[model samples]
Target: MRNYVGAIAAVCLAACGEPGGTDVSSAPGALELTREADGAASGAWGQGEARVRFASRRVESGVYRIEVRQNGMSLTGLVDAEQGVSSLDGFAEDNGQDTQMLDGDRELLAGLYAALGAELPAGSALAPELKYLRRAVGLWAEHPPAVELQRTVMGEQGRGYTMLCGYAKCNGKFTGSCGTTFNWYSYAKHDCQHGGFDLAANQQIAQLGDHATCDGDELYMSGGKWVCGEPDHQSRPKVQGNCFGRCGPGCGGDTQYTVDATNHDGCVRNGHALTSAYCNDQFTAASDDELYAPDCY
Candidate 1:
């Protein structure tokens, strides 16, 4: 029930992105709960980073660890914003606002620990609310559709490996007690409602849009927004033209060509931005905005 992918929604949340943009955060994964807590490791994420990684290793058989190294180093953080502002920002996900959330959690954690072979410390964060989670996990496990979240899927790694995927109703807000009611009717309906998860089997992964994978982009989600060190972007279907000038090896400086513009790709070389106006000339058919940060897709 964590909105880890919620970061990308802020810029175009109500505005509607590109009219036909690829639905980025809609994918469902088991590592969602884990990533949400890791990226936004405050408030509801009482589990902490250490535990999340340990539990994660149990799921994909250390495949996640391998992917991190394959990717870049800057992608360490996934989602995070500020005080009291969780990934489900502008909605709800703190323990303070809801108590029922804390109720059955004990059992929920138990089931998770049992499945992952992780041992819950005698004293752990959110331990008080666990008993609350336990009951809910049981009901969801016992019930048919509810039991679906208790679901597990074979990982992309193949070899018949599986990952645990789970879900519950969370409206980013609680009417009174945690389980008492939901703020958004959609979440209460239990049809994804922006809470379904899609665990990345790798160490870290994200996307800027349908155009580019966040692999080497150092992209992350924070306070319902995507955060990246550089504004580098690639077009969808992977633009297959000559990657020239700043987009390739110049940022407009003494050593590099880093031009500060929406259409300029934030390509960096020699520790400076790599950009040049010549790129705009190459893709004459494209709008200036579309060329922003045009790099080798």
Candidate 2:
């Protein structure tokens, strides 16, 4: 699955010495590999046509544990160069895309691939698309809904209604990933004064990883904020970068709320309030007068 915020970058460079430079041929060390298949166990070195070659130089003078096998059959065995001994382990099978060792053994898989001078199988059928969608759903669950809640509350003079909403940000574990966006709207009637509100907000929390990009009508609503323009990918924070760093200054925990009449022509004269808060956090309550509007005919 595409990781959200915690996806680590490729570490092959740091772990493996400059690619294509590490020589395994001249290593002076003993390797012992075993393979099991078809109700029989065998050594890994000097087996049938499918065998792994052992090569090591300037290493420990003791024996090393290794095993290789495929389809319940022995393919190659470990080698003791100093002792001049070789054995077989299991057989290899061609599974179309790449060679696969039936047993649940990676060492055997690597050995067989090395012997054949080919890459190992990709392993498993969890495609990239399914993995990412699952992650996006999980992120949405943690944060508060971006839509404003309109409720009726009892007051001294009579019953009053209020509208509330805010912005929320969800961090994806993987880097360079993108997510889907959504929009919402609502209307209501109370005490003879027909009331309605409309706003637009964009949600990119789902695609924070997988390096996905989106652009279309650009109409979206989230946390009471409206976004109509396209986001600049080049300047935006990447999923692989520091999550916390992008949380504030970069992503800017800001939510914009605006009140509009049922006509939807313009804001309710004075209905825009700007607030600052972290993504996924709740919005503070506003006075009834600040959000409530009387009948407008």
RMSD of each: 25.1, 25.5
Q: Which tens-of-lDDT digit does each residue in 91-190 have in candidate 2?
A: 2233212232222333333333232212111122322221111111111112122322111211111332222221112232222231343212232101
Best by lDDT: 2
Q: Count the clashes in each prediction.
A: 50, 61
Specify the poorest-scoring 10-residue window by lDDT in model 2. 1-10
lDDT of 1 by residue, 1-297 (tens): 001233222221122112112122322212222223332111111232211111111112111110010001100111111111111111012221211212233323334333321222212333212221221222221121111111111111112111111111121112235443311111101101122222111111211111222444433334555554332222111110111111111111101111221122211211122222222222121111111111211
Error of 2 at 55 (Å): 62
Runs of candidate 2 with Cα error greater than 4 angstroms are 1-271, 275-283, 286-297
| CA RMSD (A), model 1 | 25.1
TM-score of each: 0.14, 0.14
Cα displacement (angstroms), candidate 2, residue 252, comes to 4.9
